[model samples]
Target: MDDIRNIYCVGRNYRLHAQELGNEVPKSPMIFSKPTHALVETTGQEIVLPGNRGEVHYEAEFVIHISKPYKPGMKVEDVVDQFALGIDFTLRDVQSELKKKGHPWLLAKGFPNSAIITKFRAFPGVEACKEVDFSLIRNGQEVQRGNIQDMLFDLETIILFCSQHFGIGAGDIIYTGTPAGVGPVTDGDRLQLKWGEEILGECFIRLG
Candidate 1:
C-alpha cells in the first residue's frame, strides 16, 4: 500500500465559494486536515457513504501531490509533482451543528472515504499553469466550473502557508478547496471530473 504522509485542505480558497456558503471572505487561508487514510482512488470503485450523516455534499477541488521532502525555503512551484481533480465530501448537516456550537469539524469533514481523487498528471510548474481549467459534472449537468486563474490565494501562497505550520514532505497531498455550486448527492448520482480536455475521473454515489 502507498502511504500518504499528510493530507491538508484549504477552506474557502475561492471567493465565490465562500460567498455562496454565506461566509465572509477570509483574510488568509483557512486550513483543515484529513487523515491520510481518508483518501480513496477513483479508478475502479464507487464512493461509499456514511449511513448516519444527514447529507453529504460534494466539493470539487484541485489536488496537489508533493513529490519531494519540502524544507522551509523551498518554492511551492518546485514541490509539486502532479495535479488532479479531487472531491472533498462534507457532511453538511454535521458541519452546520458543529459550527453553531463552535466545535471542530472532525466528523463532518474527515470521515473515511471523504477524499476521492483521480489519476494525476505531471505538473509543469506554476508559470506554465495559468490557463488550466477544471469542471465537475453531476448527473450529466455541469455543477462547478473553475479556472486556476480564479483562485484568491494562488498555489504558492497556499503551499507556503501550510508549510509554516507543518512542513510539507514527500507524499503529502493538498486539496486546494472547491469552487461555487456545491450540492448534496443521492444514491445513483454519477460524478465526472474534467480538466481541460482530459477526463480526470468518474464515480457513482452509493448510499445505504
Candidate 2:
C-alpha cells in the first residue's frame, strides 16, 4: 500500500448500479480520483470513518494495479500486474447533496480511509477473470457481487480512458466500479471482501 501512487475510480460503470441510484448510464467511463492518503488496507483492523456526516455507503469493486507505464493500444494483460477487491466507501448524504448542487464529490468520496483495499495478487489474464465473482459480505450476508464481464465499460476501455486523460502509469490503481446493492454500513459492522471462494480481506468498522 505504501508504494501506491494515484487512486483513480470509475463511476456508474455497472448498468444496474446506475439504475439503482437513479443515475443515467454514462456514455463513457465516468472518472474520479482520491488522494493517495485516502487509502487504508483491510487487515482485520478497525476502519474508522466519519460518523456525524450522514450515511456511509459501501461500494465493492475490482481493483487493478498497474505494473508498468501505459502505452497507447496496450492490452490489459500488458499493463496490469495484480488485482484485488476494494471498497469505495462513500458519504452518501454528502454525495447526494453535492450531486444536487452540481459540485465535485471530493468531500464525500475523498476522505481519509474512504478507499479500502485488500492484498494484491497476480493478475490472471482477462479471460480467467471474467469467470469468477467478486463480492462484499457485511456481517454474514452478501451485499454486493460483481464480475468483470458485467462492467458497462470493460477493463480495456477504462485503462485507455484513464491513460489518455489521467496519465496512468506504474503505481496507479483503478477501482473498477461497483455493482448494485449499495447501502449504509454502521459502526460495529464486519465487512468482508472476497474473490471467488477466497476471502481477500476483512475488517470491523468504527464510526468516529
Candidate 3:
C-alpha cells in the first residue's frame, strides 16, 4: 500500500442527494473527508462490509489529482488542470448510524478499500466537467444514475472553499460529491462507470 497524503470529500453537492439525506441544499458547498489510506485502487479489487451493519454503498465522485501546492485564495482555475474520475464508496447504513450518534465519519469512511478511483484523464474539459453521464450497474441491471450538472457545488467553488479552510498542497486528492441514487453493493457484484459510449472503467466488489 502507498502512503496517501490527504483525502477530501465534498458533501451535499447535489441537491437531490441533500434532499434524499434530509438536508437542505446548501447555499455553499459542504465538505467531509476520509483517511487517505481508505482509498481503494486495485483493478478487480474487493470490499468488505461489516456484518453488523451490512449495507455498503457506492458513491461515484470526481477525483482530482493535484500537481501543485494548494493554498488559501487558490482558484479552481489554478488547480483545475489536475482532475479525474472515481468512486467514493460509502456504507449507507453505517453513515446513517454514525449520524444518529453524532459521530465523525472515520469508521464509516476509513475501512480498507473504501474508495475506488478509476484512471484519470485530461481529455474532457474541466470547465463543464459535468458532461459525463454517471451510472452504476449492479450485476446485469441498472441501479444508480446521475449527471454532473446535478451537483449543487460546482468544481471551482469546491476548490476555493476547501483551500480556504485547509492547508492543502500538491499531490492531494479531492473526491467531489456523489449524486443521488446511491445504494449498496454485495460481494460478487460488478460496478461500471461510463461517459457516453466510452467505458471509463469498471470494478468488482468481493471479499476484502
Candidate 4:
C-alpha cells in the first residue's frame, strides 16, 4: 500500500449499481477520494475493521495501477498497463447521512483501512480488461460480479477523466467502481476477490 501515492475512486460508474442505489447516472464520472494512509497493509495480515462506523459495505473494484507520473494534460494511452483487484470498503449508513446533508464523504469514504488491493500485474490489453470476468465472494458465497463491458466509462476514459480532475501522479491508483450487489460485511467473514477462476486476493474481516 505504501507504493500508492493517492487513491481516486469513481462512484456509481456501473449502470446497474447506480440504479440499485437509486442514484441518477451521472453525465460524467462521479469521483471521490480516500487517503493513502487509509490503506491497510495486508501482505500477510488479516483485515481488522474499524469499529462503530455503522454498516461497512464491500465494493469490489478493478484497480488501475499507474506506472508513470500523470498530469492533467496527459493522454489516456500514456498510462501504464498494470492493474489489480481490490475492495473499496464503504460506511454505507454514514455515506447515506452525508449524502442527505449534501456533504462530502470524506469521513464516510476515507476512513482507515478502506482501500484493500492485491499485487499489481501487467494488464494484458484493452480487450482483456474489457472482457475479463471478476467477482467478490464473502464467506464462500458469490455476492458481486462484474465485467468491464458493464462499465459506464471504460478504463482509458476513467483514467483520463480522473487525471483531469485529480492530477494523478506516479504510484497513484484509480478504483474504477464496483458492480451491483454490494452489502454489509460482518465479523469473521472471509472475503475473496477473483478474476475468472483465479483468486486475485483475500481479506479476512475481524470486527471488534
lDDT tens per residue, model 3, 76-134: 65764555557777777778888989999778777766777766666355645666666
lDDT of 4 at 35: 93
Cα lDDT of candidate 2 equals 0.95
Top-TM-score candidate index: 2
TM-score of each: 0.95, 0.99, 0.86, 0.93
Q: How far does residue 139 in candidate 3 sit from its true spot (Å)? A: 1.8
Q: Which ten residues in a row have the lowest lDDT in candidate 4?
A: 69-78
* Candidate 2 regions with alpha-carbon error over 4 angstroms: none
TM-score for predicted model 4 compared with the true structure: 0.93
Q: Rank order by lDDT, top first?
A: 2, 1, 4, 3
lDDT of candidate 2 over 1-208, digit per residue (tens)? 8899999999999999999999999999999999988999999999999999999999999999999888977899999999999999999999999999999999999999999999999999999999999999999999999999999999999999998888988999999999999999999999999999889999999999
Candidate 2 local Cα displacement, residue 129, angstroms: 0.6
State residue 17's C-alpha deviation in candidate 1, in Å. 0.5
The deviation in Å at residue 110 for candidate 3 is 1.7
Whole-model lDDT per candidate: 0.86, 0.95, 0.70, 0.84
lDDT of 2 at 40: 92
Model 4: per-residue lDDT, tens digit, 1-208?
5678888999999999999989999888888999987776446358887668789989999888787866656555577668888889988999999999999999888887888888788878767677678999899999999997799987778887776777767788888999999999999889988899888888799876
If the candidates were sorted by their TM-score against the true structure, best first, what order would they fall in? 2, 1, 4, 3
Candidate 1 regions exceeding 4 Å error are none
lDDT of 1: 0.86
